[model samples]
Target: MTITIERTRTAPQPTRQQPAADPKPATGSFQTVQPDLEVTAPLGERYDEILTPEALAFLARLHDRFAHTRHELLAVRLQTRVDAANGRDPKFLPETEWIRNDTTWRVAGAGPGLEDRRVEITGPTDRKMAINALNSGAKVWLADHEDATSPTWANVVEGQLSLFDFLRGNLEYTSPEGKEYRVTASETPTIVFRPRGWHLVEKHLKFHDRAGRAMHASGSLVDFGLYFFHNAKALIEGGRGPYFYLPKLESHREAKLWNDIFTFAEEELGIPHGTIRATVLIETIQAAFQMDEILYELRDHCAGLNAGRWDYIFSIVKTFRSRGRRWVMPDRKQITMTVPFMRAYTELLVQTCHKRGAHAIGGMSAFIPNRRDPEVTERALAAVSADKRREAGDGFDGTWVAHPDLIPTARAEFDAVLGERPNQVDRLRDDVQVTAAQLLDIPSGSGEVTEAGVYDNVSICIRYIESWLRGTGAAAIDNLMEDAATAEISRSQVWQWLHDNTVTAEGTRIDQTSIVRIMAAAVADLPRFEGDRFDDAISVFRSVALEPEFPTFLTVGAYARFL
Candidate 1:
């Protein structure tokens, strides 16, 4: 589905209704009430409400003071609007309909064709890495200020300072191969910088231009406010990219707030309204429940939603940790895509996005291994391909790749899936039948567990069980309980779990073992079936698990098994 929104220019409309009466005085100093009716407080208590008559008269007398303050605020807002309009808002380009409609800005909507497409390049630092990622072929490359790279106050300041430099074509960086690359003033890619947390705006102001001006001098660049200030010709002349991926979103309000801010920024920046695009991550259970509302909030601007696997799992565990015995753990392998709720969430995302003429994108394939090992690379590539295939089959337009080596595999997977018609499989409906017992088992200790100490043991047990079932190789638990090659693939499955949790000298944790165990568990948990049919299905599961790697079916299988 393709979504095209036209940008329109318009003045700002009042967001709140006028208050009926002046606000009453507070205990000591006078306080104003919020103008909105929803503010339950009495008049004069809310910030936007006018104070008592005396206070109002006094405020009237200080018209000049208020005017001065108002003018200053307007100036700051205007500057921010300009910056945001021009795509120089520091952290991200403010997404608004106007920005999207601006004749100067053009964003190539990347869909299934570009899902697995990535161009690998190196940069000297995280900033450089960002620039290179943009230049590299992916439609969006997150300048991770959050996880992959560590940036201190100085780094943040320098990075912001370097934005203009990057735009002006004066950025240089050395690749890992020791090759130096320079970006001149005329070259710019679709770039987005992940800023420090909203609370750290003060620290981001340390670096300024040659005149010793702070980047955030007007206080317009606070807490995503930067996306509004830099909207002007100076920035857009290079290129106005109207998109952003909002990470770590925990509620519908956050999405709604962004929508409101974008609405205001569009008007202030003179950009066409509704041009900016955003993608919110469903990383927490709160976000999961609010998905419908959150997506509704940004329907016009939203590109799609992503299934944030690891963080989502972490959130589930955290949200339900207090339940004690009621808490059942998710299978490690199934954690990525298999939880029934997660599957439901993903399907809802896809359905919502498609319904809105948007493209649903998948989350990261973190299992892709290092590039140095040929065997690892091949395995990683195969796994990535399978994942992409599953995502495509599941109606996702794209997926994420952490390492460059997985790029080709991801692309191929997307291509293969895209080549097939969507909705081809009758069983591909988003809904899956799950019983109450299955739901209960989701948090059971015997189910997939996430407790810190038990992860290794559970993982090992799962892998060993699968291996034994495969009848290919023997598997042992803690170097004991060795099972000779047997038709019981369940034992080998246990070994597979152990392998997934095994910590190598290189510090890389592979999920292959977990994958096998998940498959075995699924086979073991199949519904009551007599003789041949059950045995045949179990054999197929064992064969797939014994294979090097499979697609993201672990989640589906595990969820089914749990059910």
Candidate 2:
């Protein structure tokens, strides 16, 4: 069952970014200031409210001040990958060991409305979802603009508008059928926004520094700046600050970068320092080894750490893909949280966070409830409950749920462990000891690449990629909340299987041709309703999964080429 495909790979090249000798950027808010910043995308309805001249200028300032550091960190990420390929694997920084051992230093701990995060509902910030999430009886609402929502220009601006309305008590939605949605919860979940990662660029916005240079803006700064500038003061006045969830960070240096941005933003906005609290997602393997240092770097403005499971798996695959069979993973389904390596990662996260008086949040369980089928919903809830229970028993203070209905089940598990306490941050798992080798121990997991797993990977890659292309980043496929992180795992698994020449449990050789056939069948199974972009999705899956060289992220190349 070998496919007649080119099995050769061109080695990955080093990606280095050097600062321009002079950078020019400005956004004229009035007649006095020249409009040095340009908007490349068309203005959508209500965009003016979010993209006011003053906000644009503030965003421009942030870009100019921090863009170079973002680029340097990104380059370091690539070099780290290249170094791993050459046998220099990621390890704890010797220079930062002092920070790791300094037991007296502690993070700012939890901010207002963030003390108890037992059940956090994660979704996009569209008017409807925002209301529903607010009404949902969860402790926090992760108003996600990152992987959960596609970064279409309209979405970016409108998302800000939604958040603005939410903060001002002005959010109201009426469906075409005249049904109304409102934030009815007496105590709505606290909002913690998740911006796009540093690797991404907001191409629609162009910045010209005072030094007269033009370049695309960093998506991180753009999202953070607009939201922080417009909402920070309001949030502070409302007794909540501009809290955030920092994603895809690879090193402690990147944590320092975020800490600097937080300082600058607070000073610029006239808000007090340490007002902005951030929860860093320990998704990358490199970051797992530097948890203590990451918390130390942002101690003044840090909340806690989250175990982003899917992206963590994808990161492992991306960082160690060129290392051959020892690094190859089996079916994505087989990499459960209880697996030894995953156990090590999560246990270590809980241990590190509790040791520093920070919350240890658990990862997302893709098993979402099904509304149409009572039987399916029952099974899904059971699965989600079990996963949440494990996290709670293992010392996690909170967990993530994609759908609102699953909130109770997750809450119950946490309540069972948490009792009347606000959180279990005091439960420091001192007994948990994890080594780098344990964290990197992929072979210990029990699983294999079955033929069914290969086809499942192909089908998910095609379906999820199509959903993303159609401007819905979070898609419910096969009864799970599929997002960019899960899609990365799906596609990268195929690439990994092909790269390692893995054989299914039934002894079939997995290859590109077989995957192509499986993808076609998957597409055939999906109803090609009007406006659906199946063809485009297939092409994206092919490009990302079948390429000779592995893409660091599935979204980066796709976003750069299209949208």
Candidate 3:
């Protein structure tokens, strides 16, 4: 059935079940939790293939065993942030110093289909993008269900279905303009799926706990559970194990939680232990200091680490945006991979991952090629080429690109580095010595916050939020790929600049009055459509960017209200 979403075309929602009212809490173990959990979203065609009873039961089991731990870790994150905000600054952990000092341990290096991740195209797992990614000639496809996807119930459910169909060799798509495309390629890229981060919840699925209390299901469990439950065996049979890109983890404890989940999932499904491989994104400030411990905790199943640069910057702001002008940063474009602070982070990451036999993947540049403008495309290619070359030369085994157009450029850079080899993990980069001060150096970069920077942040944040509220998470704006991660940095910078009372190079002070004028101009400049959500976007931007207290994530609040 065609469901009427507030879009130009119909978007299908998931198939829901109105289970009998069961207010009773669950007993010990997952049996009780699985039966009482309810799927509240309405249904659509072929939804049963993904939302089967078995899948929900598996999902509930994951929640049952690990939900409390997830909550506790989230609490630790809040306290840690609070501590930073209150002048309790962070340093390398004294307690886990043993893990860092011990240099003998190593992660179970690249599994099949993951060895040569030289050029990975990162995007949402929607049909069109999935097909483009698979056929993009990249070595790996970061099948993203996290920031790149709008977490509508349809997107959540259909993403699994799309991956399932692609794995089964039956996936295809046709444009509304009557062009048909099949998911065929000379060699499909290795698929590494990214589940949502731990901080959010899947409100559509309500779980009743032992206390007889109903709460939202864990988004991580829902996304990972459905995907793993349905396709683990098939993936193993097809020469690829179930791989994951874990996002926004704050500590080694969180890594241990995922390691435990992987172990349990392998056993429950009769797969051999260590069949699951995960590459954790060191997005948050806390996780940056725990790289060695994180790899150690997941050594049995760990594959590598990725420098989630956009969120890393946003994480820094969220942690210390309210402190003072000393912690205040410059424009977003100014913080490149070569910056002293970012260089320390990436160097330390490479050192830690290489010491433990894991791939060090670089971050995406976000400068996607604009096809309509040849000069813009040329400039984007140059920018992306420079970015990828820096990573390739700096001892990274692989890197990520947002658009398929940049795959050749990224691969060329890595190809020049690793001509006949799959990766350079053996290059331990032991000469790279980093300290806590270098990693947390807030005053290193040199750039001024200009009026142009302020306008860019406000307009980009509003434009991105509008697209997201319209059910499109990823969009092209100003010759770059703008997703939830980039949007977070954009809005956070606006908030950070305004909160710190930043003055531009022209001596223009960033205050509520200036922000309002900029936001009004941004909204008015957009091409108005009948179903646009600019109003809601403005409200979301206002709440997250201009509010007194920071919301941990912009998507969490906007998703609750709009999606």
Candidate 4:
């Protein structure tokens, strides 16, 4: 499990100031902008380790250099949507055809701990959960700072603290019930940090431009900067460098932005070039078409691609919600990975990744087993097994599960195919010949809208949003690990249904008015909670879900409400 520098690429280094000429901070990186860093959020005791002056300076440097580009890329995202609305939808980029056609290039293959990721469990980075996940018997723990995490100041700071302890083999926790949880050497998973996506802003931290205008730093940069600044050397010493799961990238340009950030950070920290590895989440429809170029842009640092199913569905609905009924999707349950579009998406992912000698990781099975109910647990396991069997059989190197209880089942499925193998990267999936039409084919009769579906959507979203407001992002509801992505899917599907003015199977017509009623009733039925975030959550949900214009992500607006 040593850090793998064997396949590390040697490229022309970026020009930087000599250590003697630069002001040496505690992190040993030169400070570019020394503007006063402000933390507006509540600072808990012991957060100093994560938000040290040197770390804040590192974050400020990253923001000063790349925050403008992040803004520009967001604008580009809006413009892409506008162009799609005007009949210039995203397609295979002719300009980047050379990158896709050239088969000679391959990404830096799997790094040390990531070489075998047959089953990666994902969860928020609370101390207890962090300890449990690292010992969950999964190959990798997606230490999530994104959808599975609510951006409360305490959670953010404490999560960083947990990761700091994890790398040093000192992660420990004792529950209120006196249950002790600690990392074990016998079953430790590789840690892959999933920062917030590019769309989010860290309101707690503020930076000023040269013009003296204050602005919030990009959440992605903050999470990435703080983690790399604090733990790059520690993780490397632990036989792994900083690894990331980049989510919701829409194009190769975004991926290139990430690559540039990686390069800059590596040089700034004096780490080896290509010491960082990333797995891009192909969660957006636009990114699906640009997988080849994304990998190409980060080839020197890319590890693979992931099939992020729920958010991918949310993207499809959000991107094409105004296109009339032709692209209107059915119930979420019916649009499982076996559907035409999803199958094409997964097949294309495996084909593209294996073609370029990268690992092709499958989507998440978010079912948290019901330990008290044997029948429910068995059924969940059966479904998860089938999903992994399909993925492993179809040439995927690994798959994801949200709960540790299902890890043995998922691992067994992959073990059937990857016996004595770290990964199936050599399984090139030459048989997957997918075309644009095949990938975009909206399946007919996927599922009918029903009264049950409508109510469930409202209920699940309200439930999730309430927990999110209370500082928990991953909520166990109905035996499923529901995160912001699931809430997105729930709300977006309802919006799509309302947009299409579709009638349910049981003759219930879904309208904005009806949805509002359902939302009200859903909230009213819930037991009294301690806070008013339920009201705020419902307000945000209604605006994003029922409005004429769809917001990019529910968390963006909802985050501002609480965090």
Candidate 5:
């Protein structure tokens, strides 16, 4: 099957507007004073009165290591090379510049045609089930590795290696009819893989080559990209394609790093650079902040970014846990592409990418249930339809479906959404002429920073907690936390800072004085949650100390005395 790229006139175009002059970087002497207000400790004398000495010491060690991890050495090297090659300053394009000057960028807009794109996952016994799903007109088939797969490390290694075997027609399996079935090399539904997370699960996938040398050298970054590279030949030869859904990306740097790796793989393996497509999950709060950068970094190789709902929610809560009551729990339903900020973010993403002539695909409709419940399926289909309607209205080219059962429903909904003619009359509306700059510049409480022009204090506090949890460094800034809603921005900043400062798993030169100040302030002002009673203070302190900037002397001393 030949994949055709269609150019639609209904594609979004930039509205007419006067472009503003480029913004000059802020200068002049600004007051550098930290906020000086003081409050009594909510926990009173009991605040520092919680954990055992050993726990406190462990926390200190953990914090020290996290604050000093070398997370971005390779990324820095690659970036330096790219910058030197381009012979340009490496300063990132400002968000405002991207919004105002980039007129060619189009937001994801409704298209007239919708190619039915549904994905189904098949297992060892369910090859026929998968083929049936594909025959039913599903556009994509994602072979599982993370969730739907139950393969152990050995099996995973074997399965991956056997992929080439099957694709090459060297391997055959017996069908239910007692006949041998062989895979014919032919283009079919787009095949993609959802691999295991890098942190915990990737270790299990290992394969040795014919020379008794490991195909993936242990602890090599090449291990991550090589698996795909080695199989590229088989994939293309077998009539499938090369594509992947990358998970657990922490920031744009990660995306860019992957892009560089992919570039290397393509060049080394003699495959076309754009042939292999990648869809990164903007799951973590940090990933969201760097969405534009990430997209831009991987623009040529990227299919699109997916809004991972559950992981994203978990990221938000984890990032802002220190903000206590001030942090609002995001309503999952309301917080999707429909929510104001999210809508703006998604719209901005669409606009930025489309302006550059890239696809702005929507994320998953995770509400779809199993095939066993027709009522649930009906409701899910309705929800999918509503979501597609919204996405169509907003101009998204495509969306994702989590379950195989929902593939048909999702494809149908998208098809229905695409069938409608672009309302030329609607295009003539005043709102249609409003530039993205104006839309983004619509003043709201969400943009407020402190006098320091940093994020709000609560937001900073939340970021501190999150960074600490992740074993990263912390700094207090009043304005950084105002819009705690976009946890990605806050978390990414912390990660960037950690990366820049050479934070490692080993200890760093932490500012003990700054730590004391932050601890005293947090202990004084922040309210204790339930279970943060006197008895829990030691435990909490120990946990918090494990953060990058835990008040080492004070925490250690307190724990020793308490124990």
Candidate 6:
């Protein structure tokens, strides 16, 4: 049975079906929360292969079982942030000290295609991109739907269809200019899907709660459910099972929730237990402090841990936005891996992951080479080589890239270190000792906020949000793959600098007056678009970056406005 969306190319929206909110729970051990499924946008050609009744029903089952837990966890996140903003600071969890102290337990061995992830290219699941990524010669492709994808109904549904086709060896695309792209089976990277973070919700699919009031489904579950429901068996039967890159995890309890969801899904689908493996991104400041415990919670299904450097910085800003000038960050460019605080985070991550026998993956190098300029390309390649060399020397099993061109550079670095070995999990970095004080030291930057930097932030945020509103999450700006993380850090630095009323190195004080002028200039500088996406982007940026209270994520507010 085909379940195509009602597509409208201009602004594709899911069709509406507001089923009367039933005030009572359904009968049986599981109270069935039947969602009023609506295909708001037109499902493009061949979408039926993924949006079938069976697939939606499978997602519904996942929602019925785990939706409540997801809500409670979100509540916990809110309260936790509130506490941090209200003077309660994040530190090592004493309660889960036992999990951290236990050194004997190890995560299940790397399942299938995850054994060698020396170079992973990350991008959205667009049709041509999907085929190109698979044939990118990288060891793994992070099929991203989270920060890297704009969650328009069309993008959400079509991305699923694209992955479905790739998995079945039926994926191919021709560009608007008539360039053919097809997946090369020989060079195809093992696919690892990165679902949206837990904080967001899929507003179109409204499922009733126990009280029978309609509510949006969890974005994490929607992405995970649809993918797992349809392709788990096929993936397992082939070389690799279903693998995931879990993002924005803030606590070990959240990790436990994911492990439980995986167990339940495996049982329901009759797949063998432990077939699903996930690499958790320790993005939030809170998660960085609990890396060991996070691994312990998902040890049964954990593949490893990734140092999500960009969001980690964004989290530091959000968590301490209202704190004194001590937490005020300098320019975003000043914050690098070499900084004492960042070094503490990455070193601790490797120590924690390797001590527990899990792969310690490095953060992303978001440099896109400019092929037209030989000098520019050479400089970019040198920077990428240096970054990967540092990671390999520091005991990271692998590193991630935003473009396919950097794969050779990254792989060569890891290969030089690994020789014939797939990974260096055995090289436990016992020499690294990180303290809480060092990790919390936010003074590594020069404390120089320049007006140029501020204007740059405003422009990038506006440009990024404009692209995002137009259904592109990953935008190429200044030869970098700028995702939500970039925008988050950008808007966040502005807010932080403003809250502290920081004076730029050029003697310009950052205040509302200066910011409004910058905003106006940014809007004027934007290229003409025939739609209100530009205006909406400006409003969203101002609201999030200039508001009295900081929103957890810029994407959360913008998601409601756009998608």
Specify the highest-TM-score model's number.
3
Q: Which stretches of candidate 3 lie over 4 Å from their true place?
A: 1-35
Q: How high is each candidate's TM-score?
A: 0.52, 0.93, 0.94, 0.93, 0.50, 0.93
Model 1 ranges with Cα > 4 A deviation: 1-125, 149-151, 174-179, 183-189, 192-223, 231-240, 328-334, 367-369, 419-441, 444-563
Alpha-carbon local distance difference test for all models: 0.43, 0.85, 0.86, 0.85, 0.42, 0.85
Query: What would you estimate as the lDDT of candidate 4?
Result: 0.85
Per-residue CA lDDT of candidate 1, range 1-563, in tens?
A: 21111111222242221112223433555343322101112222122212223222221222211223433444553454344334331221124333323333222223222222122121212345555555555544554433232233333334444454555555666778998766532333344433322212232222222121222221112313333243233445644544555655654556765676556555645766665666676765556655556666776566557676655655444343333434434334444465565666677666645544455668766543544567865765676677678777787776766544556677666567665433222223435343324422434334443432233433343443344223212233332222211112222233343334533333434366544454455446444433223443444444434444431222124212321
Segments of candidate 4 deviating more than 4 angstroms: 1-36
Model 6 has a clash total of 9
Candidate 6 has its poorest 10 consecutive residues by lDDT at 7-16
Better of 1 and 6 by lDDT: 6
lDDT score, candidate 5, position 366: 49
**Residue 289 Cα positional deviation in candidate 1, in Å, after optimal superposition:** 1.5
Among all windows of ten consecutive residues in candidate 4, which has the lowest summed lDDT? 1-10
List candidate 2 segments past 4 Å from native. Answer: 1-36
Q: Select the stronger candidate by TM-score from 1 and 6.
A: 6
In angstroms, the error of model 5 at 65 is: 24
The local lDDT score (0 to 100) that residue 322 gets in candidate 4 is: 77
Candidate 1's C-alpha lDDT? 0.43
Compose the digit string of candidate 6's lDDT tens values, residues 36-129.
3444345567666666766665666677678888889889999998899898888898898888888789988589988888999999999988
Candidate 4 residue-wise lDDT, 480-543, digit = tens:
9999998998998898899889888988788978887887778778766566467777787788
Candidate 1's TM-score: 0.52
